[model samples]
Target chain A: MADRRPRKDAARNRAAVLAAADPLFARCAHPDDVTMADIAAAAGVGKGTLFRAFGDRTGLIRALYEARLEPVRARVEEGPPPLGPGSPPRRRVLALLDAVLCFKLDNRHLAVALEQTGDASPYRTDHYERWHALLKELLEQVPGGADADFTAHALLAATRADLVAHLADGAGLSREDMRSRLAEFAARTLGTED
Target chain B: MADRRPRKDAARNRAAVLAAADPLFARCAHPDDVTMADIAAAAGVGKGTLFRAFGDRTGLIRALYEARLEPVRARVEEGPPPLGPGSPPRRRVLALLDAVLCFKLDNRHLAVALEQTGDASPYRTDHYERWHALLKELLEQVPGGADADFTAHALLAATRADLVAHLADGAGLSREDMRSRLAEFAARTLGTED
Candidate 1:
């Protein structure tokens, strides 16, 4: 029991740092404005703890992004209709994209921060591969003669964080507007439009 | 005659620098590996001339990209049907995307470097706006009731430089395969497929 104390503390500290970092990233005018020191100060942990936990700013941002993405990931993994297993592939594809768009809309700052990390290719991430693989699998099951592999990439590209930011922030598209536009676009691409 | 000589020399130097830089960017394992010094040495010009002509690395890259894109731009602007002004909007759209895809495929390293510049949003570039606007205009002319604005963006997103690099370099797709797949994807999105 005594030996487990440090492990428990480490977990708590990580959660605390993530919790503290989330709102800081969300509220910042720019992602670069929120630094390690800010996160450590906000989390009530030492800067050493913050760096030790995440290695660097990019690492911290990645973890925070994943943490924030947990709910959506869980819903897709096991929750009910439109997102989880058992739904029609066509409907699931639309749902998945809509969910992704909404998630980006909701986490605009974080998404931009993660993408702006310079060294990370959005295409190279584990998160991207998981989404791409699932979307590609579903696309292959659709009845249309669309090339599933390329179509999957094209469809996912429509919801890229940078594109979403351009539409939402730069173009002033409301959430509902962006959602409907993406749905229509995806449906057309999928040949599933009614 | 003396005044004109300096202008001619500057023009010659600029052309030489672009000629030298083009092959270097295309051949380098990474864009960062091909620096201004290397370009100047290859062009047989002073590094000062390189900076004076293009400002810095990003400026130089932008100029080189524009210079390379010039022939493509000319073809679309006035050359002939399919990519130019008189073809059916549907066919023209397909041709336009194919041209963009091929250009990215040919200029993979340059495209990647330009995209990886970190601060420049691809969406914000004049080059992107021109392509998007032309694409949007063509989509509006197509028979489908698709949202021209969003559909144009979605279509263009498919041919983004990084996405192209991922397909060509990372995914090991050949140029022919990518072009056909993109053409098919665009056709499906436009509802112009047979």
Candidate 2:
């Protein structure tokens, strides 16, 4: 048990280091500009420990991406109503958009960084597919039995980051306004008169 | 008058060169890979004439973009029906979307190239602002008057090539299906109950 405790502590430290580094990298103008020493200092771990934990810069970046997406994955899997299960499909779709919008706005830096790196992060593809599937399932539950796959694609396209950024930054639309409009759109597409 | 006819011929040839190269470059794997020589060959003009018409590679690219957008601009300015004058705002909005979708789907390569090139081109900013304005104007014309800017952002986001690619490639949604759902979503966001 004592030996197991040390291994667990090491794992916790590794996670903490990655978590701290993830946002920093995301917010940086260029991820390559960040140094391992800076990350170690921020994580409160020795530089040697940082290298030992992740092996190299590429490894660290991969770990950071995974750490960033874990909560997002869990939220979609089992968080609560709107984002989770139990809510109507229309509401769930709206909630998903809300969550995604908030996440993108709050973590714009990291999102931009991840996008710039061009790594095939599974989170993006997996989350998108999951959202589409969920939307499709919900659409099927509608009174008129709408086309789930088509509806899902439309909903997903309307919530993309580039489109959102164009709206928020380019068109000067407020976050609340965007959210409301999206919700209304979702409701209509799902065949809910209300 | 005879000299003026020569000038008119030059203008016609220039227009032809732009039209032919724009679609070809858009579909090509890399814009840089296609040279002035290639464009001239494709346009059935001498390389020297092509160079004289557009100063350099950058100039040629700009011309291509301008040529592609000209029809859209003309429609917005002087066309008729849903995308032009003498129609309800609701119908015009749908028409504008139909035009854009068709253009995008047909020139997907150009769309992808523009997006991948980032914000280096001055045309990007200008077009973005113009599209936003157009969307806002259409939205304001809605019977009850909704948030035009927000609706614009959501609608623009729904039409991005990345999202279209994702739906077509990742989710296997057909083009027809995506278009219908998007139209339905757009109608709802515009506040038409039907």
Candidate 3:
């Protein structure tokens, strides 16, 4: 499979480009400030090679979004008790808040970059749908009196990245404090009967 | 009193500029996508006059931020019980969620732009700090532990504009659903004994 060598190299180049672009886009306050050449330079390749690898900036961004899902899913599956499967629905809800907050805080730069990329892309839409589905499943496991879907939407809204970043960086609030408040808010909203 | 006439005209021009810029900036996916010329056209003023009034793009954005605050405060104070001052802390908390969600939904464009601006400006920093203080006061009244400040910060983090947008627009969750979930989450986080 000597012919496959270039194909494998292309794959490596794509990954390397994404890895470098993630932080650069995330940390910048404005996405427009980043150029294709910048991304190519950061990826350690020529500008032409960068264009060939991702086709365009939007394609590169989409790849970044796709790459993030794996870690996010793994974190949801095996990171911690409340965030993972072992804890009760109530505790898991709280854990999810913490996990999301932590993720945003850790990747604040990349998170903002992706959001600023414009609304034409389906990346964010798909990501949130998946998150909403997972949250809905958790709500179903809780008290079953009211509409779980609506409740799940509200909970997700309250824990958005902009809100998280505002509290953590803008408002100077600590992670633990943010988690506790959200946990309390979730428990009451979910009718935990505590 | 002739000098007063020019000053009054300037004030009116400034107001018109801010009003026009708010909607244009808000509706745009990227704030930079909005140029000074677009704002001037929206304001129905001469392009030169727009530049003379606001000085530049950043100055216009700052004015927009400040101008919106008065309306927000009024809504928070004069709106219905849960959002206003008349209801129980619990209901008030829910009302706050409703108020915020409605604001974001109605002004989705502006909300997204302002959030992307981040805390680069002193005005943004102060605006966020005030909200955290207000949240802290509400949490302190809830009879929880002395860690009310922390709790308030956490709730704020979860309820910022980006997160709300992510849930509503990006995630395709309805406003009503988000409100209900946040209300429950707030109740539990506040240590509701019920």
Candidate 4:
């Protein structure tokens, strides 16, 4: 293993770190409690390798979160009708929000970890801007869309990690119930009031 | 000053601590960066006194924030018109969101400091529950209100401290612009299509 090609060994090391880190994050009560040493030990790689591969704990969490979210992002960006640009603005907005909610729901621990990073604001993240911009653009196409920017932000705020965590754990709402409630709320928000 | 009555001196020290802490929080780039030691020195009080008065850093931030927000709370709880309970539900909801947003704008530093505390979920705060319950009740009174509970949370989420700080500082939006945008968005939300 030590004598393997550089590219091949690095790729193997990267995969090993992610594989080891995912379950630790999932099982931890607090994400920050999972540390560099833990990931390095679990991955069976040197601490130096961990540092070289991911800049820091935050970087590793971000990578893990992004990796977990990739499938959903792919679907939203290009998969089809509702999430893709093909659907009507109203439907697309709902799809986008639901996708975001489901992503947070599915990755609660990762989301919480990413959100709780010391100096990182979720708003400053590349994906947050992408999601917000996509939603804002869709919102502009809706009939009464003057405040698309703020509305886009407000809708996304509903799916924020801590809020989702609170509703899921503190409020004890079932996952399905939370999803349906969010969908209903978004529909009302995006639709002409009934 | 040292020889004053215990009750009077305690009151003076408490007031001094809050007064000193306020500017330090406002001037610092990050809220948590301002230490209790820093505040104690600024207030000319012993570290013991600062802790005794507020319990902890989180306690101090909460007290200062509550103190700053008292006027707005008073208007909502007792004063007349849109913010008061006497107003129509639809109008009251808009007023409440506006008032919350304005308060965040007016006290950005304090809000950020209060929010960055550890082990404290913003959802668990007394003020948050009070505001949520009030908004939920008012929302139920508004026509076309189906999911009033979730709707209330969603609306309030729009005014989260970090988001406000980001928009104010990162987005560089003026206070009036933010208020109007929020008002317009909430009106659309509470109204039967703008």
Candidate with best lDDT: 1
Local accuracy of candidate 2 as per-residue lDDT tens digits, A1-194 = 46545487688879889778876766664455678898998888998888888887656765665566679768877988878888886677778767776666555555444443333322245555676677678777777644667666666666655556555665576888777777766665555466
For candidate 4 chain B, the 10 contiguous residues with the lowest summed lDDT are: B185-194
Which 10 residues in a row give candidate 2 chain B its minimum summed lDDT? Answer: B115-124
Q: How accurate locally is residue A75 in candidate 4, as Cα lDDT from 0 to 100?
A: 93
Candidate ranking (TM-score, best to worst): 4, 1, 3, 2
Choose the strongest candidate by TM-score: 4
lDDT by residue (A130-157, candidate 4, tens digit) is 9999999998898867678888888899
Q: lDDT per residue, candidate 1, A1-194, as tens digits?
A: 45544587899999999989999988876677887899999999999999998998889999988888989999998999889999999999999999999999888888888876766567888888899999999998988557888988998889878889889889998999989999988888777456
For candidate 4, the per-residue lDDT at B88 reads: 84
- Candidate 2 residue B47 C-alpha distance from true site, Å: 14
**Residue B142 lDDT in candidate 2:** 83
Pairs that collide in candidate 4 are none
- Tell me how far the alpha carbon of residue B172 in candidate 2 is from the true structure, in angstroms, after superposition: 5.8
DockQ of 2: 0.22
The CA lDDT of each predicted structure is: 0.87, 0.67, 0.67, 0.86
On residues B126-184, what C-alpha lDDT tens digit does candidate 2 reach at each position? 67678778877987888765567666755776666555655565557677876787676
